[model samples]
Target: MSKKSTIQVEKVNAHIVNWLKTYAENAKVNGFVVGISGGVDSAVTSTLCAQTGLPTLCVEMPIHQAPSQVNRGREHIEQLMTRFSNVTTIEADLTAVFENFKSIVPTVPDLDKVNLSLANTRARLRMTTLYYFAGIHGLLVAGTGNKVEDFGVGFYTKYGDGGVDLSPIADLMKSDVYALGEYLQIPASILQASPTDGLFGDDRTDEDQLGASYDELEWAMLEEEQGKSADDFAGREKIVFEIYKKLNASNQHKMREIPVCFVSNDIK
Candidate 1:
């Protein structure tokens, strides 16, 4: 969790941009489409796509999103458009769609379950919107997930934010993503903003839900990779290690390939 040495931002940026371009060309897609949530991950992702010199469409699908989040997203899109001619922005406000769906769905007695389900519904709605744009434009849906969120903790909603055509920054750690964001000159508001999924429509951060900060989670991930267990640590470290392990175990279904039932020849 200690401040690590700086990464080779220039080289990393160029590598990802070139990789994106090559992938798009090989896939026969026109370009990339990304959902901008006014967060650092999305901002960095859209910028990387724009750098590919291909048509990068940044879509803002706000479902009861906070005003600050919407403002920051618009700011980043404006900046991106000014910098790259290939970039375009669109706003698909799905507030009414979400409300209508809520009204039609059967009401549950458990408010907690309903809230969680609705939060995930928000993410899935945005995912569907992104794919809609990608479908019409012949573009790939670029994911905005980072290492700690996507693999370490599985913080994203399955078939929601996790659903994507390609992940440009999945391998990079949260710190590494911020480094790239700095090098890419992402807007200061986004860079300084606390990392949130923006699904709950409130100010609760990822740490609030995960029970640990990204730095702590990153440390635990490294420790696990080095063959260390929760027993090795005490106090806060142990707490975080357990939290990381619990999430990793519970969310393994998200990280691995879907299970399938096969039929043997004898059965036939």
Candidate 2:
């Protein structure tokens, strides 16, 4: 795919439709699975899959998403229920899984380290659930991540959210995600909702973790990639630079799969 795609929202939609059709036919996939977090990224991805005329199973794995956030996710799924009659919503509540394991270690690590661990745990649980559905019904997991979230910094949990077989929006930026949601006619309420990880209370958000808002982070990342001074973003340049730097610094390992050496010189 092109780094700069000329594909408009409508064109993206057509591509999604054809891709779904071809992949399903080739793999003989019976259904689709999507992890909907009641956030914009997830809602948009799930809606795209559902609209593609498959039995897209939208799963809301609310480990710690607030009641309001849970409601938002439910509402998104409900909205899809009307359009995709084959869509089935599942509540993959992960509270028990985390609870059973959180105290197993007894001593808590540092805040940053613990938070990173928790984030990875949530993502792994989500992947497990997606595969659970896929294994039972021969479905494909429709991962909900955009370029800004997954590739720019590799800011996802490898063997977790990063373990998906296919991603529908892997090439879109944060801004483009909103535009696609609008193009897909997702509820305006969700369109306006902030990008979040739903990993904590209502106060927790992805921007908080990255230390930069959508606009600032995107601009800085783009400038950095172009070999330009990311600090040219005016008074807030420092923050933006920090955001890109932090994500890149923290998620370095998420980008690569396990590497191998020519121990036996075997192609196997």
Candidate 3:
């Protein structure tokens, strides 16, 4: 879709809700478990799941999370629970668990490497926590990643945020995700908040690491879809396109199906 392309939120919302319900039924799961990050993607996905009328767990797994981020997460869950009878809010402070994991792992020489590893560990810990609940409740772990992050740029960490039983918004672009969020009447704070993975203790926004805004990234994706070359653009636009290409290339492994080995023997 073009930058100007719009989504029919009502139709898309209904489709996602139905898909969640059908998928959970087919999987023989009782409900869904979602990590509520207080961002538009998670808010929209959780809202859709709650509309399914199945038991939905909005778990806030905060590990060294900023106070503001934690508050937003809690408030969003509270709002969701108040609105949906089947939605429930839960908090799992995995800070101590993360610290324990860090203590056990062999220390790398470089601080940057150690910090990056720690950030990813936080996500994996949250993933593990989500599954722990899912295991007992027989629910699927619903992912909040959008199309640009999941397929285009592969922004999520492998086996971290990437580890999920289902993804409800993986097909929608970031722009479309926001549109759906607005349609759902999600709290203005979450709708207006900058997106973050909540893995980094420093609280850097996604765009901070991405080197481009979601709009620019989405536009580059559209350019790719239209067979437009980056060279066709000039100045800052070209730079943004280059950043998009670089990220997509670097994270390609995360975007593809895991490689496996197959062997066959022939009799002599």
Candidate 4:
């Protein structure tokens, strides 16, 4: 955490906690459930949920060939959950889930896409698991999407990882997430580890997939926020825009509600 972040961390933390509480109460939810992938976004979200005094579940769903890094997710979540009244941990094995799609998942040539599909499967499974538990436990599925992922590379699966009862960190960028993590005094080791999804090998990372570091992403996104023309990513800009379009077009339905009409209920 930097000097600037330290100053605003407390306020940001409080704001998000309050936001989740209000959203939950209004939605008639018991608390928040999150899929913790040992990533920064979910880490920040889980901490804020704990600080919000809401029951939170941080699940780690790992796939095949995953490394010891997968264990970090559980440890980090356990540490964060210690501060809350009720925080549960779950291990939803994705090896079986991925097996269901193993045959067809290999069509993509690039390792990134194949891993994305695998990771996406795990994400959807995690979301489904959240709903199953939330329904039984009377809680809500709290999405951990940050603005950089949500807005920039459009970094999320459609109905899969993107499904949520509510999103608390949707407005903050990737960098701000780390800021909140620090204020909550989350473990330093977890805070410093490279942000990743634990999808493929330990090497599979969100930064590598997005083609930019969180810092650079923050700078580029902030420029867009200021109503300025998009910043120059130069050679990578084409691929970046391509990714943005693909995710935007494919996930548009997730961001929309089904249209419905009343059967002349105007009963005047």
Query: Best candidate per lDDT, number?
Result: 1
User: What's the lDDT for all of these models?
Assistant: 0.94, 0.78, 0.89, 0.71
lDDT of 4 at 75: 74
- How do the candidates rank by lDDT, highest first? 1, 3, 2, 4
| Top candidate when judged by TM-score against the true structure | 1
Worst 10 residues of 4 by lDDT: 1-10
Q: Which is superior by lDDT, 1 or 4? A: 1
TM-score of 2: 0.89
Give a tens-digit lDDT track for model 2, residues 1-268: 1123334889887787678767876888986888887788888888877776778888888887777778888888888998789889888788888888787855465887787777778788889988998899889988788887787767567878777768888888878888788888887778777777766545777877777777666666777888866456556676677668777777767765676765665655
TM-score of each: 0.98, 0.89, 0.96, 0.79
Clashes of 4: 0
Q: Which pairs of residues collide in model 3?
A: none
Candidate 2 backbone overlaps, count: 0
lDDT of 1 by residue, 174-261 (tens): 9899999999999999999998888888899989999998889999999999999999999999999999999999999999999998
How many angstroms is residue 187 displaced in model 1 relative to the true structure, after the best TM-score fit?
0.8
Model 2 lDDT, full chain set = 0.78
Off by over 4 Å in 1: 3-5
lDDT of 1 at 170: 98
